[model samples]
Target: MKNNLTKMMALDIYVSNLEEEKYSEITTELQPSSKKSVNLISWGIQDLFFEKELFNDLDTIKTFSKNFNWKDNVSTVIKENYYESLVLTDAEKKIIWVSNGFTKMTGYEKEFALNKTPRFLQGKETKETTKKRIQKKLQLGKPFKDVIINYRKDQSTYKCELHIIPLHNSSNSKITHFLALEKEAV
Candidate 1:
């Protein structure tokens, strides 16, 4: 048990160091220190493989895990020479992945929203046509992109033009995942 805890702590430290290094070389408009600290604790808790009690006691761990894609967003920003973006999941619909230029546009850190569903971006005024389009594509294992009104957590709406591609896992025709991208409309 002690050895396991030690290993968990070691791995957590390694991941935290990597994150710190990455943040240091990247964005300067904000400090990711708070997010990093939460992530470090989350990693340690997960490594320990404790019970639900411990897990929920540090609900931030779950929050951090869900937002794990911020790392990807940061890397993408660097690679594409953009500012920021968001990645989402359709966990209820079957693990669909989606992303938006959030950091580049909105100020929310990816760590604060790792496992969030893109529906969080939806608004009361958002057209059903757009939802239908997404459903059609999701059903047919096809990819599609369109412009629509999307809301942020702050109740502010913005026009988002986005696209998605279905990823198949097998030559036998098994769909494994969907990768979606959202870009702010001009």
Candidate 2:
């Protein structure tokens, strides 16, 4: 148990350092500090991994991990380089959340994406078979993985690897939302 805790703490420290380095290089306007000091102790950093501070202050690290809008900090840095994007859509297929990675990948701003169906990301080159497969899976509330050509805001197309899962309500087990994760073709 002690060994495991040590390993976990080491991994947390490593990840915290990497995130800090990434955060420093990302857009300054969007950077979010982890949190105030009070929150860190209150949240019990020792319970997280270690009693020692990670890359940043204990409070900052705690806030960032537990309280802050991690999506914003991660979204900006991740999209500019990494190929990952997350999308959340209602059962009706209207967009609810489109990660910043999606914006960077497709050039469609969040404001433009809200309430919009992902079909807007398709263009002339998009495969009909892939679209139909995606549609069928969603209609059946099935998780799906596929590779398809997708269009960006500039009308340029890129090959995308897509994975989608259905989010279900706990009580009735009815599908409530869809989560899509897409990675750029490498």
Candidate 3:
């Protein structure tokens, strides 16, 4: 219970950080109604009293995202932190989401990356073993972690510590999405 409460608090902080970054980017003042619609300030507070537990596990968060449209918030957090996040289209295995971290790290914007395969980030220096291991884990619908050489939009190479987690519809035991979390290996 205590752990869950801590996670809940952390999520609050996380949301605040994201809101700070998001609002910073907007120069115009929105009308009162528009602000209420665009931001979740009051909604977040109101929903804090819900009956559900508040643990921040990846799966639990994914479930909330699926049910309540928190998916945008999830990716926005990654974008705000300049941390790479990619969501594959479950079975089809195409890019469905790419965070701004792609832009900060690779110079590729969300508009250009969506609908493209993640392989676009790979180049000659990307090792065969790394690719194969990722593929194997993905095929097994299991979480995978590895360091891989990835290329930017400029085609420059950098080592990335990649963590790919299979997001499942736990009730049905079916993979609904994959989350690719990455950090600079430097």
Q: For each candidate, what is the lDDT?
A: 0.49, 0.62, 0.60
> Can you write out model 1's per-residue Cα lDDT over 1-186, one digit (the tens) per residue?
567655654543334334457757654633445643322557666445333323332343234334543222222322332112334344245323223345434455555555665665677989999788777757876544556688766677777755554544334445444545565554
**lDDT of candidate model 1 versus the reference:** 0.49
Could you tell which candidate, 1 or 2, scores higher by lDDT? 2
Pick by TM-score: 1 or 2, better one = 2
Candidate 2 segments whose C-alpha is farther than 4 A from its true place = 1-83
lDDT string, candidate 3, 2-57, tens digits:
67645644443333334456756652542234443344468665345222222222
Model 2 TM-score is 0.56
- Whichever of 2 and 3 has more lDDT, that candidate is 2
* Steric overlap count per candidate: 8, 1, 0
**Can you write out model 2's per-residue Cα lDDT over 136-174, one digit (the tens) per residue?**
867877565666788888898987866666766545667
Q: Candidate 3 regions off by >4 Å?
A: 1-64, 67-89
State the TM-score for model 3: 0.56
lDDT-better candidate, 1 vs 3 = 3
